[model samples]
Target: MLSHLNNFLPRQSSLLMKCNFSKMFCFQCEQTINGKGCTAKGKCGKTAEVSALQDLLIEQLKHLNSVVHHAKENDVKPVTTYSDHFNLEGLFATLTNVNFDEKRFQKYLHKGEKLIETYLKNGGEKLKSVLHENGIQTADFSYSKPLKELIKTGKEFQIDLTEEKRPVTFTKELIMYGLKGGAAYLDHARLLGYEDTSLYHYLSEALQKLSLPVSEFSLESLLEFALQTGNWNLSCMELLNRANTESYGHPEITTVSTTPVDGKCILVSGHDLRDLKLLLEQTDGMGINVYTHGEMLPGNSYPELKKYSHLKGNYGGAWQDQVTEFAKFPGPILMTTNCLVPPPKKYSKRVFTRSSVGYENLKHIEGDDFSELIKVAKKEKGFKNTKKLALKDIIVGFGMNQTLALADLIIDAVKEGAIKHFFLIGGCDGAEKERNYFEKLAEKTPKDTVILTLACGKYRFNKKDLGVIEFKGNKIPRVLDVGQCNDAYSAIQIALALANAFDTDVNSLPLSFAISWFEQKAVSILLTLLHLGIKNIFLGPALPAFIDPSVLDVLVKLFGIRPIGDVDEDLKLMLKN
Candidate 1:
């Protein structure tokens, strides 16, 4: 049965068959151990067993996607809601640091197999014949195999990294990662009642191509598909933007206190605004003060969420700090999405996960009902007294709407040389010491320059008093927080609007990007930049391990993408250009 499965599965194109099997293989993030694949265990604390299970889940999802793709192509009504949402959650679960429970992956595997069965049953004989003719197997596969057997089967599907197959493997991984990011954003939008069937079809088609043999595509074609993933990601991000802004009024420049108030508290982490909104609604007047952590810090800027007086200020810094931060917190923590680190046993009992987030021994919230979470908060002692920090508050909510509202002032400042340059110095933040480069870059920018930031990376220097640039009696913050990583759409809109005001293109403007990426969402945003013909993006602290020399060369030559260097040198170069 294993051999039969291997016959139908996509294989790498390589002449050398020498195999050096490791315990596990994964290199989907910037911090993969030793700048290569993780073998013994994931740096994110994922075990080899969990890694294998995730790989297997992806393989099974590809098979299911093939059925959905062919059904749509053959004019059979595909199960849009089930298949699309399942695909989103399945891929998102495999992203770095999202889900770490082995049992959860097992359940996902079973659910995917059942989804394939449902799609085939709905398509009837005509759909099955169409799929079979296209070399897709419609036969049912058992996910009910024993745990050991399933793990063994999963190990057989580790990514192909042969020297001869690097280019193809790199391009395929790029597309897959972008799709994962897109799926994450789409899922957020879906939760807010925004759905685009075309986006769903595109995802199914892309996954189908990914399941095909390497020989079926050239490097050029795969690269094109990867860029298309970026193009669709732009649409996905726009959809999410609308879903967020429409559901909650557009974010405004608001001051959020970093200090905790005296009351029962719940620290809401991750990037889901909808989750935060729901929690805020449920916890209102319950004496539970909700504090934003990690990417949720931006939630305080939205009008609808801010209306809940109990929605207190932000708590910890970036996601990487959760282990220590979560331990010291006075109450329970709710992890709404990615960037979750495995909690130590000390505080594991106080942590709860929702949606696609999961950990082995921690409690999971099934739906909008955070009753148990609130109950846990009520049992725990909240902050006995308010504590003040050196930085009392930080300003956020410089999204498109807020920024464009000051367009005339910004344009006049630039024209008068009051604001000399614009720097977009933000992306996913990591624990690496080198990531400090972004902080330094932001700090060293000339006082005349404006810095635009998003995602958790802003936490690096968000509290710094960069001072405001005053022009024509108007004060504009030198450091502007443009919301979450998904809010890159707002950053792009700001740039386009500025370009139009200047009567030129974005490239011709005095704007530059120094991106600090650590995950797939950053990859999707990078691809979107490349799709827009943007150039000279400085990416760091390290390049992706999957991008071999050849692929890196293509990116450098085509998009002028460069790796981060000495902070002084990069800053000088950007200012000089």
Candidate 2:
């Protein structure tokens, strides 16, 4: 199918080169229409030029990584940080709805090229072999050129699908998406001062492999790369799990308020708890309050972070509702990481980005100093009075440590037929109305069943009264909040413990996964599940746009991956099976 589209590339490329840009072919996120690639514009409001610049930036990352790989093979010390930094930021920038600024991507591409030039200039005979090994036919030692002149050459680096089959391309994209997601998690861990040099080494090697010609790689090789992506993502998750728990202590089971306080306030969103910790520290005794929003809601569960009195509670739902929610938020909002949508004019001035997150005309904070945000918060009319969005507090912090402690009771309840099944239903959430399916499924789940949820997806039904069950004189909440998306590691741990207790594999247990994915982090999580041999996962609101029909068929046959059916029917199917 992709080859057929490339038949007109001869004419298309000519026209694109003349215009100094080309059409984009992106379907990285779940919102892609009809599950086909977006040609003219991205569903997330990204333009062709921005997508092209992102691809160009990734291409340069590949080049930078190949240089490092070549240098390492030749036993030469290289400025590997050049490649390492880009590997983290560049891939993160390409995540769905993360960065839409063409100029930012252009700067990254230029910086990446200069880093490559430095490698070539410093490298000798060993560098030559390195370049050859990375599929570079020739080398130019010149680094003095206008940034535009170099950026214009980026069109030559755009992804071409004439040679590779669509399924293979889809698999490659799947693997790359997983790596991008893993890199985002790794970045968070790095911010907390955790480092894994071996993981970084494998990451560069994988990026270098992406630089090789498509014709040289086979489907089998692509499959292996996808599996390796899962392996690396597992390590990345483990590293983050350690970093988060060691720094913040294991998450404790607690109820978080969904209300606003009567004072000047700052709303901190995204997945970074370290930023939240910093903001909470600075805001302490300042007469201003701090609140969590979106994925940051789980921050309320961490023992270290939750100790702050100013850390009030969660503000909004998921990232999709930010446009309307941020405006209603009277105080300043700080987006510390990904899942940022362009703010509306009404609230654009109130939104600030930090760390790899960026948008045009928005203030970008460089460090822990959130004074600007504080000033803005002081100026705005914050919650004039305390108002509760929910009468009852939402439960959170049911991580592996907390869940495993109840293993004996859970097992005994299962034996006594008090607990029927466990459904792990959560991941990234989106704006699609079809996502209501998750809400319905969760609402309809039996009272005797326990629902394990994580990430922003839990917001769809977290506020509901799912009721509690009593078994063997122990009380267990029906819905368990398993921390943030990264805490899917906790879910994995709980599953393993349960499987071990039952003397069976995870797939054989009375457990099911009904996952909702909107972006690459969900992709990484799904790959990790596959790597663990878990099967029959029901994924929606829609399958990824990047997957070809044939490729999806292969996944279904091998892994029992299925799309969500009607809420009632799917719930019944999960319980019956």
Best by lDDT: 1
lDDT of 2 by residue, 322-434 (tens): 99889888899999887898887899999998877778888889878988889998899888756543445788989999889888999999988999999999988888888
- Give the poorly placed runs of model 2, Cα more than 4 Å off: 1-21, 129-134, 137-158, 161-164, 387-392
Worst 10 residues of 1 by lDDT: 6-15
Instruction: Give model 2's TM-score versus the native structure.
Output: 0.93
All candidates' TM-scores? 0.95, 0.93
RMSD of 2: 4.7
Candidate 2 local Cα displacement, residue 302, angstroms: 0.7
Q: Runs in model 1 with CA error above 4 Å?
A: 1-19, 124-126, 387-390
Native-referenced Cα lDDT, model 2: 0.81
Clashes of each: 0, 0
